[model samples]
Target chain A: MKTKKLINDPKVIIEEMLEGIVAAHPKHVRQVEGAPRAVVALNGPRKGKVGLVIGGGSGHEPTFVGFVGKGLADACPIGNVFASPPPDPIYECAKAASGGAGVLFMYGNYAGDVMNFDMAAEMAGMDEIEVRTVLTTDDIASAPLDQKEKRRGVAGNFFIFKIAGAACDTMKPLDECERLARKANAHTYTMGVCLSPCSLPQTQKYSFELGPDEMEIGMGIHGEPGVAKGPIQTADAVTDAIMDKILGEMKPNKGDKVAVLVNSLGATPLMELYLLNRRVKQRLDQVGVSIHQTWVGNYCTSLEMAGASITLLHLDDELTGLLDHPCDCAMFRAG
Target chain B: MKTKKLINDPKVIIEEMLEGIVAAHPKHVRQVEGAPRAVVALNGPRKGKVGLVIGGGSGHEPTFVGFVGKGLADACPIGNVFASPPPDPIYECAKAASGGAGVLFMYGNYAGDVMNFDMAAEMAGMDEIEVRTVLTTDDIASAPLDQKEKRRGVAGNFFIFKIAGAACDTMKPLDECERLARKANAHTYTMGVCLSPCSLPQTQKYSFELGPDEMEIGMGIHGEPGVAKGPIQTADAVTDAIMDKILGEMKPNKGDKVAVLVNSLGATPLMELYLLNRRVKQRLDQVGVSIHQTWVGNYCTSLEMAGASITLLHLDDELTGLLDHPCDCAMFRAG
Candidate 1:
């Protein structure tokens, strides 16, 4: 498609967006010059509090950036849309957030993010900063629970963030913080269905394609291919398809408590998410999995695709308390 | 071109979306069940506080609904994408929000919104409920300021919301609140450019079209036909063209304080919005217009259109105080 270039240059889009982020949110986040998406806490770290950090591509709002605030990730390094941020930015974020107690790096299971964050951890160690990495591999379709390294991260990353934020608030050591984040990730699973492909700005075209009336199941946020495609179904059916996989993997038994997130992948209206959420709660209720809380909205979107994703996180006492912690931001806040 | 039938029935899209809004913001907003997009104060209005109600279409997140909080609009009556909510719903919103101090009905200047909100005003009057309408007609291309009725409302509706919200919070009477809102709207002006069209759920297709390398200037939120269409160009050139008309109408004098909003039309990424915002600020700086504050993001979106609109609200002491008032919500809290 022929599209107007709204950016001065394709190269500067990421840097400029980071600058605007600093301008718009002076209290919650600050960006270092020449380091795009390398955001840190404006108020430093609270004494006796562990620090939490997360990072990924730039397109998803309220994710790596929007989720940075009290009772959430203390700092988030952002990459360009559909791209992974580099190691230096990640390293800087860790250093800035580390409160003397230590810092935990919680990120999605994407290969690029994993590799870059690992390198940054090594760098942080050289600077006498204790850092640990917690990878979230919650897409059940990507791998079995025993082989979580192969799974792709999805909306369940929110669970990891919530746990890490809460653990850090209690001043857990780096080891404990990483352990809790991993535990949260292991207990969470997510699956998504897309009605349309998300478009890239510079490319000015969709990242992928599917037939009309077709939906892709178990898709990743970066427009990665899905596990299956089939004729469109009712919202209830789609919710069942996603929740079944997530629930099966989590294996919640009777009386088990969980938090559910019904996320819109950009273009889906709020109406469909609610309808799908209602069906999800109904199905879960029948299965005896008690939904302690629910988050339904565009917390994680894939550009403008008409799609939705479902994520379920089995919760424990610590996780539940963390999830209940208050958050404050323009995109999301939970108390 | 063909499109997918994502929902069971196209007609149910709006109803479903509103249900999702209620689910997502249960603590902050509640859907007037069976009433299309009419949401009232979750915690009933504070006694003796004036009420501010505003709304229009569904796709503009936090615009009408997201802005509802302590220092902004109290309720919103939503319509389908780019459509106005009915008079009944708007009236319900007014009735629910109004305290003994009366109500201020702020809205965009679209024909449907204007007509429906006006009707609601008359209905509220019949019930002996004092109500006033502050119509926002900021799109410069739609009409000249001298011909107020000809101007179309756009993103500048936010300025009215801010002013009205503050006025009402201070217990201003119905007429004073309306006067302040209208004054803010009158001092503001806006213009937009569309690189892509927003897809309405029911239509399952884009509302308008642009060739692969083309853009429409002076476009409306509803995909109302623009004043011009031409091949896409550099960000600087596009900014120059759009700001010329908006600034010409509002005519921000040198040394005058003003607030700028560079808004994304749903699908545009934050990276691009910031780039556009940078150019916008640079242009305004060159023109010697002092920017009191600026915000750039998807404040008012049109489905998933990959375009943007700019709004300039001339700031005086009253408007500044209103803009500084604190707000708390999931989307925007510009108090």
Candidate 2:
């Protein structure tokens, strides 16, 4: 069967979606003037406060845009499915989020996002709006333990965005907010597994093929290769496998507190996520890692891809307080 | 490929999921002692307030369980996949939620849930605790206008639950809380379309089949047949088709306000939901209905089902205020 989609013209999907978002959430967001792809907070970037701008490809709903709210990202420039926004919108986002205080640009460390955001930062510099970039590298499977800098960011982007956004709400200086964001990134870890592939609207073809009994561990959000592929395993076995890799790297000692996220990668059901969480909590209990909180739902996705990712954010007293901060956006709000 | 799922035993899925939920959200919820499937709010059902218990089948996560928090449903009983909870758990849920005041049992109006909840209510009545039920029959395609009571509930359950829960927060009496619930259900209307079918874990077989180019309009949450089936259509066309049936029966005059929910049935991407919402907002605009707030995500799902549902709650001042009232839940919160 052909992959079915509800779209008019694939090329204009992003613009149409942006229009819908701003219209549906007029009080929360608006399109940046002359930057159709940039979605800016309607009530953010107040005076004497550092501005936080986040962006990345589309498909990961509530990730880059749903997170932009009163105390989260001030602006998010959207891109095509699994692709990065261009420099123009990214620059416009920096300008919009700039509250006289300098701007901080953050996103998952994809090659396209890094290049385009870097370009946008350069453009913001030309306008005398200083900008700093923090590329999130939390996907443990993307790189070896000794080379964590090369890891790709996955669901852990949510934590980095929240910590930095909360810091900005305190009217913190740009340097301090950037430091908090880096610290958040350093303590975050994520790993994912995909059961099926997601097709693109334009192409109408599946991105990858897996056998009936196969599962791929550490699959990237955009169908990038993972560390291993084998027959599908039980929920407990899968948890152990993924956690083995993450805990090996993160190594949160006993008595440490952490926040856990069991996120669906598009098409996975909540029942499955919760079932997986059952084992996740068991393992955390055995390891003596105290769960400060838990978020289980479809937070970041791959546009109908069938999979899930687990994210762990090891929290200190400071990080816990910052994460508990409240903010309201379109799809997510937390305190 | 076979339908992939992350579960240990299909037989114990509900029990295991409930365990995970209480473990992960100890502050928000707990499993009623000796009634493991009956999940009750840890901090709710306080004295003097009207107790609110809402529940239904499993698979539609964040619907019945996620809504159990402060100012929302005080309890929700777990069921097997796509099946309703038995009377025992439902009865226990009511007893746990009861705090001297009466209990209001609200949920989707399906035969199984109705029968089970009715049995539970009868049991509660034996204890001298008044129990009132507000059955949601809001699916526009399920019945004729004059036979609205015969309709089945779909995504509209969210609005009904929220409004009724908010009313209970006012410490209203049983009759008044039931009145508010009935008012909320009367104003709520929903329509859904499916692009693919969901499979059961035990069977690993698709619930239904659509040709590569086919779609089903007004499909029920559990793969029940819809009002119409045809070749797949564009996003705008689909939205217009769904909205036409909704508006024809609703007949909302100009100057009416509404809360819109563009819900994904498990696997539909958020981009498509937004694309559909663009047309929904446009049609509502042309019809002169003012959108008060919009929600676009996986609110009600069918366990990896690929479809979307649209729900509109025509709101008066009271309902609108109640909807905007603050409530903190596991998956949903509003202020």
Candidate 3:
């Protein structure tokens, strides 16, 4: 395989990306000095609003950082591509986004992020800035359904963040915000597949290998191997496979209202995502599940992997209203 | 080269992509029916505001479509892959964005886009909706300064869009908006290097080819051959080469206020863009052009090419103010 020189050094790449992100959305987000890698909401400390902070890696453009604004994550502690931010940066971000009301550390269920955010939450607690953690364990394929707590987080995170952030945006108490976030997590399920592997910029080699016609199903976003491998199939076939697994695990009842998210895993085109969404919608309709809203695009990506994921979120009146809430961020808007 | 099967047939790709774009930023942007390929501002009829519309190809995600909102292009017409949109889409977009006020079509100076946009302008005139066209011809290498009108546009287009969009947002006259956009095009210059080729989904083959260690300098966003190709070098050297050419042609004076944009040609990493930005800032500073603002990211792209471009826009008071103007778009915001 051929390799191209990377555009920047790894150390300061996320910081510079943050600079561009802040400049692009100055009114919505701001960068913290001591925590240059962290981006916080410009109108944060909404004076009694529960602040929600989320972050993981940087290369996932628009993930933790781009979503930092009203109706979303309050601040993001960006690390290197697919790497967790150090504990110090995470702590500072928690402090910065925290109002007198307290802060929620909502991060993907990755070991690195979990450990660092836990450390940061502990540190924030010492500073009298109340802190809590709500890990998104929505990737059902990542673990057994009986042990959902061990599932990895995936694009379904956007759903959790949206509902949780909306509650906070409306000045929900810290406990209420955390409760809503957990509830959202419980109802959400995501499963991903990958056709290509990501190359670490410094290494310039695939982190994992895949046969040309082979794809990994139930894969994590970071190019990690999945629970199963299968021959590449049609968009509908792939969508059916993912939907069957997710719905079977989620076990949505007939007539249940849910939101569907067909997330492009990095390099999948919109045409493919929509095709997959169509299949997913059709399958759900046949099963008597009503999709209240649907999002088809690249939300959670894994570098340049040409694949997609399906995330289903069961919704109630409050959750549905929160999901429909308006947002203004550089990369996404829920309304 | 090997080919992989994507999820969908080519027939309905653009339609689905547009739908996803609208769903992604529903409040800020939506699709116009007759203009099936156009994404227009959701906030219609801004009373006295001048409307700005810009577009060309489809694969340059976030460039034409992502820029449609307040303080930016009011609408965008998307073509397939690197192709230019037909006149009908552009005309429908211009009509939708126009609110009795005149409209400015600020598109990159590519033959297809220019021809179609001109046709759209003529159609708009027939409808009595005043319209003007401002072509961005910032690729100095594409044409000699004496023949600037023939130059092709590249990454410097962001400058024209920002400045002209801000003026329009302020309800500036159509003539004023066009003049500012033209001025921005004159002061701006860009040079790009492509480390790899990007493939069209339909073709499933690279638009063009490049060697493992060869980089194309002065490359257009489309797959057109670059001005020159050379042995790949260090990030600093590559950045210096691109910046020297752009700055020398721009002839930025000492202490000249300027804005710098380091654009990724798609697959380039954030780290690489920052490294290139570092070298570009140092080179420009050595030449006495102080960077008043710096933007580094994937703004205008060429599919998934692994490369980056450097853009320098000489900023006067008006240009700087425009650069500083407030914007609220799906992908970019500036204030």
Report the Cα lDDT for residue A43, model 1: 51
Q: Which lDDT tens digits does candidate 3 get at residues A25-142?
A: 5667888887787888876557888888988986666567767887788888888888899899899888888878999999888999988998898999899999989999988888
Greater TM-score among 1 and 3 belongs to 1
lDDT tens digits, residue span B1-335, model 3: 44444456667777756655555456678788766788888763477788888899877766777788888888888898778999999999888888788998887888888889998899999999899888888887677778989888888888888898888888888888888888888889888888877777787777777877788887777767777888877777787777768776777778888888888776665546656766766686687777686776668877667788888888899889888998888666666
Off by over 4 Å in 2: none
The digit string of per-residue lDDT tens for model 2 on A206-313 reads 989988889999999998999999999888788899888878878889999999999999999988898888888998998999899999988889999998999999
Evaluate residue B130 in candidate 3 and report its C-alpha lDDT on the 0 to 100 scale: 93
Please state the error at residue A296 of candidate 3 in Å. 6.3
Candidate 1 DockQ, CA atoms: 0.37
lDDT of 1 by residue, B1-335 (tens): 54543354557766665555555555667766556568875654677887888888777765767677666777788787677888999988878887877888888877788889999989998887788777788888776568877777777777777777888877777777778887888788788888877666666686677887888888887777788889887666788888877677667778778888888776565556666677777777787877777777667767667788888888887788877877655345553
For candidate 2, the iRMS in Å is 1.3
Task: Please tell me which model should have the higher TM-score, number 2 or number 3.
Answer: 2
Q: How accurate is candidate 2 locally (lDDT)?
A: 0.90
| TM-score quality measure for candidate 2 | 0.98
Candidate 2's residue-wise lDDT over B1-335, tens digit each? Answer: 56788888888888888888877788888888998888888777888888999998988987889899998889998888877899999999988889888999988879999999999899999988889888989898888888988989888898999999999887888888899999999999999999999998888789889888999999999988899999999999999999998898789999999999999999998899999999999999999999999988888899888889999999899899889878877778888
Candidate 1, residue B132: the lDDT equals 75
TM match of model 1 to true structure: 0.90
lDDT for each residue of candidate 1 in A130-153, tens digit (9 for 90 to 100): 887778888787766687788887
User: What local lDDT score does residue B266 receive in model 1, on the 0 to 100 scale?
Assistant: 61
Measured with C-alpha atoms, the lDDT of residue A265 in candidate 3 is 66
Q: What is the lDDT for A176 in model 1?
A: 83
